[model samples]
Target chain A: MTRRKEKTELVPKEKQPISSQAGEPTRPGVFYSPAVDIFQTEEDLVIVADMPGVAPGDLNVDLEDSVLTVTGKVDEPDSDWKLRYREYGIGGYTRRFTLSDKIDQSGIEAKLVNGVLTVRLPKADALKPRKVLVKAA
Target chain B: MTVLRTHRFNDIWQEMNRWQQHMGDLFGERDYSKNACGVFPPINTYDNGESYIVLAEIPGISLDDLDITATATQLTLKGERSPNNDIADRSYHRAERDHGSFNRTIDLGQPIDPDKIDARFENGVLEIVLPRAAHALPRQITVKN
Candidate 1:
């Protein structure tokens, strides 16, 4: 028997000013496009993104005019230490997606845990598939 | 004199490794020998005089899924990222995140105090601080006027 993991509780979405344009630069510093995974379940569309070094308070998610944007800010490194070697660049993370009407904007939820952000966009009730029963005459 | 020479050699070797790693990054995800499905988790390392700070971007991983170990001159990180199985019923619109086991070993030329190392994970990032061995720390001498 396979055990299924229980769904995490959803938090109320926060309201923020949405940028007028999608993919437009809004914050300073090097902005890296974080790796993201989007998957659809029976009732929700889940998006998981990797954003290391981003704190909960520094993260912002906004949706406006069918565009969904995620941005994360990272603290600058200490000035006293000089960089002798570098394999990866430190910067903020930004990514945007154009959402469809099938998504229930009011029911959308997001959570950040352990450097990963998971956004759950619940599907509209009207878009869900329904089983039709045949009537025998 | 021999000990000093060995330390210098290690420094040079580490510098070369850094150059190679940077070149690999510049060329994009072509170094499949190390990680076949692209760099599962990219990392950055810094030296802060007294300790070495390493930060790795590994989001979606929980504490139970991560393992870190350090020797006097090397650090190893191993972890597994399980794939999302909840999406079996729906088609994917976009899938860029890679899932599987990952092991990355980093070589720090200067010896470090393994017992004194500190590590913390927050907001999808893992930060590690490795203090240099007592003998490896820089000492300032008083100047006679």
Candidate 2:
């Protein structure tokens, strides 16, 4: 049975603001916004984000009250040499997405590979289209 | 006296121009490097007295797809990031990732030993270490007692 494909809907930029959680201590330095790509398949919605310098152990993905958040902590390079020239600085990454009811929250999966994080949100079974047989009388 | 005064003014003017150029390189709309077509990967370079370390953010790229070449005073990185082919069946709601080929060249301002350079790619970041040439290393002569 071929299921109808649905287009993935990304949370609008205004709705994805960086919100501070209660009791979470604010760390000094900047938190950069990672570049992301959101797409949908027949079975799931996929999100890919670029977050370099973030190890798998340092990444956190949490879902609370329909809000999905991804955070990665990156430590500054430790070297004794003084910096003579710089083009970029090290920083952490934070991004959030509001999920819809169509997603199966329990079946969601995430993987980190080569500094890229891919999150798959499986569609609820009810949302999956079923092919029905027609009877000719 | 007039020649000296004009020379000093010219020196100050050149200094100001250099400062402006540096600022432009930092905050310009487009990269000042040869790879000006795309801005997928951003790089940072640092000099640590003995070697120059360069860090580039290039997520989603396989190590085999990346190329690096270094000379005494210059380094070049060339790579191509193929777009996700699995997403062909799905429609994109937000497509911000850029995929294409890019070549970036960096001038280290000091001579380095190409044979001593080392490169590593981890978690989507590429790091290159270029050690300064023996002649470029600072040397101190002992004072006679």
RMSD of each: 9.9, 8.2
lDDT tens string, model 1, A77-137? 7776655454456778888889999999999899888778899999998989988899999
lDDT per residue as tens, model 2, B1-145: 4555233556887988767777876885332343422343567677787888888888888888788998888999887777667556887888766667777788889899999999998988888889999999999999999
TM-score of the second chain for every model: 0.70, 0.72
- Can you give the lDDT of residue A108 in candidate 2? 90
Evaluated on chain B only, candidate 1 has a TM-score of 0.70
Cα lDDT for residue B10, model 1? Answer: 60
In candidate 2 chain B, where is summed lDDT lowest over 10 consecutive residues?
Answer: B29-38
lDDT against the true structure, per candidate, is 0.75, 0.77
Note the residue pairs that clash in candidate 1.
A114-B124, A115-B123, A115-B124
Q: Is the docking of candidate 2 incorrect, acceptable, medium or high quality?
A: acceptable
Candidate with best lDDT: 2
Show the lowest summed lDDT stretch of 10 residues, model 1 chain B. B29-38
